[model samples]
Target: MEYVVSHIPQGTACNRRSAYKMIPTTITIHNTGNPSSTARNERDWLTNPSNARQASFHIVVDERQAIECIPLIENAWHAGDGSGVNSGNRTSIGIEICESGNYAKTLDNAAELVAKMLKERGWGTDRLRRHFDWSGKICPRLMYDGGNWTGWKTFVASVDAKLKPKEDVRMPEEVAVQVDGKKVGVGEIKDGVTKVPVRLVAEAFGANVLWDAKTRTVNITKKEAV
Candidate 1:
C-alpha cells in the first residue's frame, strides 16, 4: 500500500531534491526508551529542547499511527555516529517506536510503516537493518534481546510482495508484425518485469507513446502506425 503520513506536519524538509536521491539504505529502530503517549508528543521533547540533543529520524510509530518526524532529505541526529553509512545520525533512517520499555505493540505498526516507506521510495529490502547493527546501543530491544526479529525480518520480506513489475512480452520473438502497412519488429527480451520502458518496445513496434505523469502511471497505447 502507498505510504500515507498520518501525523506528520505538512511541508517537512530533509535533504536536497535529486533525481536519484538515495532512500534509507538502513533502518535503525528504537523504542522511545521513555513512556510517551504518542510519537508527536515525543517529537516535542526532542525538538523543543534542541539543546537536549539534536537528533532526527524519518518516522515515529506509536500504538495507533505513524508520525513523520524528519524529512527524508535531512540528516537526523539518530545514529549517534557520523563516520559510518549505517550511523543513525547521518545516513540511517531512524524510526522511534514509542514504547514504555515494558509493554508496547508498536513493532507490528513499525514493520508495516517500514515496508510502505521503502516501497514508496523505490528502495529494496536488502537495505533493511536494525540500530544495533550501526551502533552498540541496544535499541529496538524487543527484536534484539527478546528474539523477536521475526517481525522486523518479516516486514523487510514484504518489501517486494506488493510491487508488481510489468510483464514483458517480447514482440513475437523471431516474427514481425504489421502496423499500418509497416513491418514492426517482434519479440525482444528485457530485464525485470512490470514497468518496462515502453519507449524501446514502442520504437521496435513502430509506435509512439505519450506519458500522463500526473498520476505517476505511464500511459502506453499504440504509437503512430506508420
Candidate 2:
C-alpha cells in the first residue's frame, strides 16, 4: 500500500525505531467512547501529547471517511490492557468505530470496511472474533450489549465464503532497508550499507557531506534528520 503523509497531530509518536516485528493474528474493534468526529479524533491523538497515550491502527471509519492511520507495517497503540494482557495493541490491528458524542452512521461503514480489511488481509472467519473474547470487556458496545452481533458474524462469514490462499507476494521495497523511522524512504543498499547520495543524504537524516574527489574522502554530518 502507498504511504501518504497527512496532518498528524504532534502527540502521536512511536516509541521504537522500528515497527513492532510481529505479524498480527487478531483484529480489535473499539469505540472511542468519547464520541468524536474523524478529525477530532486525529487531533486528540496528535495534540494531546501529555496524555502519554500514543498509538495508531490500520483503519478508522468515521463520519468523515475511513482514515489510514498507522501504516500497515507499523504497530499502533489502540489496544488497552484488560484482565491481564494487552491483546489488541501491537500484535493485532485496531479499528475504532466512533460511537460517542452523537455520530453513529460510522457503524455501517465500519462493518463494511472491516469485511474488506479481513478479505484483503486473507484472514478467514475462524480468525475473526470480538475483542471481548480475548479480554472480556464491553467495548464496541453495539457489538456486545446491543445484541446485534449479526453484523460482525456477517462480516466474518463473508470472509469465510471466499477464503483462498493469497499468492506469495514479494516483500515491499521499503521492508528491506530498515528505514522505518520517521521520514525515511526506500533506497538502494550496497556493500551492507545503503549508499545514500551526497546530495540526497541530507534527506535521510541530519548529515552533511563534503566530497573530496582528490582524497576520496566524504565527510558526513550525523544527527536526527526529522
Candidate 3:
C-alpha cells in the first residue's frame, strides 16, 4: 500500500497538463492500455520531457510496486473531462493500473490503493469513478470486464470490503470472573463494556452490601483493606 514518489518535474509540459491544484472529491481508475509496460515504465513516460500528451496520473501500480508521478493535491489529465467546476480532471485523484504483469495482482493492488485513498479522505465507495464514468473511455479494461457492470461491481466490492471497519469484539460471550485468582461469578458484556453482578463481586472483595429500601438502591462498603 506504499508508493515511491517520482513527481513530474515542473515544466511547460507538466504545467500545461497538471498545474492546477485539486481538492480531490473523487477517485478515477484507469488501465495503462499498454499491456507490456511496468508501473515504473509508465511513470517514466509520464514524467519524461519528450512526452507532450495532455495525459498524466497521480499514481501507477503494477504487480510489483506503485509509483506516484503527480501529487494527489494537483490535477492530472487522466480524466478526459475538461477543466470546469465539476470536471473529473479538476476534482478527482487519478490512478492508472498498469497491465503489464500479473494482471489480477495489479487489480488487487489498485483496489488496495483506492480503498486507502477513500479511507484517508473519509470517502465512501460511491466516490469511486471509472474513466468511462467521466469520459466514456473504457479504462482499466480488466475491471471493465467487456463493459459489464458486474465487472466494475466486483472491483468496487473489493474496495468496499477493505473500507469496512475492523471488528472490535469487546466480549464474545459471558466469561468466567475471578477475584484475586479465585472464581467469583461470571461477567457479561454489554455495549462493549463488561457487567458483573455487584453482590458477588463485592462480597468476593470482602465488602458488605447493604440495600437501601427507601431508595431501592444497593450500596457496598469495604469491610477490610486488602
Candidate 2 — worst ten consecutive residues by lDDT sum? 1-10
Q: Which residues of candidate 3, in runs, are more than 4 Å off?
A: 12-17, 168-226
By TM-score, rank the candidates, best first: 3, 1, 2
TM-score of each: 0.53, 0.52, 0.71
Residue by residue across 11-107, what tens digits does model 1's lDDT show? 2333211112234566667766666456667655544524244445667777666776556765566666764444455566778877743243566
The per-model lDDT (C-alpha) reads 0.58, 0.56, 0.84
RMSDs, each prediction? 16.0, 22.1, 9.6
Q: Rank the models by lDDT, top first.
A: 3, 1, 2
For model 2 the TM-score comes to 0.52
Q: After superposition, which runs of candidate 2 have C-alpha atoms over 4 Å from their true positions?
A: 1-18, 54-56, 81-86, 100-104, 146-226
Which run of 10 residues does model 3 get worst, by summed lDDT?
10-19
